[model samples]
Target: MMKSASTASRSSAVHMAVAFIAMGGWAAFANSAHPMPGPLIAGVVQGTLSALITLFLKRMIEALSARYPGSVGTWLPPLVAVLSSLALLSSVHWLAGTPEIVRTMAVPLSVTAVYATVYNLALRRVAAGGVG
Candidate 1:
């Protein structure tokens, strides 16, 4: 069975995802009176959600590290964090924007890559307690 801490970690991820979805939905609805979502509204939703991916990952890492301790807790937590955040940031495509697509993608991708690398490096040195 998974430890209480791991369960909590999973729960936290779920909570983050739910919160983002809700936020996006509300923002989209508020932006447009009609049932259909607008391009700008959709962009806002994607941006907001993508922005929080790293935040959620960071929270999850802290929670897991504190509870699990050591390497398993350390590297593993960060590994999960980096991977999930990368996955999230990858899916944030704009509805209609060809002119600035390359430029827009570059900044976020570069930032996320750097963040993941640092997170991974730190996690690797975290002690490796007992949990595997």
Candidate 2:
């Protein structure tokens, strides 16, 4: 069954919240060893970044998958996601002075990569007239 627009909006909101809270909390905990207020600042930065990424991620994957076809379509979106995640997370965390940047980004990046891969695959399946 098709989802209503409100349902889709709610789902997006929930995803964004989870990304913001879980990834941000993880970043904060990972950076807790740093100086005062640093962890808090990192949490905010990571949370905002995670939320924005989650918000756009689905559309980005859909566009990328459509722009390519066949095997390239299957793999390219996820690869781009991983690269984008690394670039964005590392650069933003560095600018934010997030101590242990790699640690803070690891889980979020991994999750993004996995989600991108699975989502892309599902899109392909649905496009090919198979059950996603």
Cα misplacement distance, residue 71 of candidate 2 (Å): 0.6
What is the alpha-carbon lDDT of model 1 when measured against the actual structure? Answer: 0.52
lDDT of each: 0.52, 0.90
Candidate 1, 1-132: lDDT as tens digits: 569767876675565565456544544444454334453555465457654764555656656666665456646665666566545544554433222333334444555556555654465455443222
RMSD in angstroms, candidate 1? 9.4
Give the candidate number with the greatest TM-score.
Answer: 2
User: For candidate 2, which ten residues in a row score worst on lDDT?
Assistant: 1-10
Off-target runs (Cα >4 Å) in candidate 2 are 1-10
Q: State each model's C-alpha RMSD to the native.
A: 9.4, 2.9
What digit string (tens of lDDT, one per residue) describes model 2 on residues 1-132? 357766866797888888899998998999999986889988999999999999988899999998898999999999998898889999999998998898899899989989999999999999999986
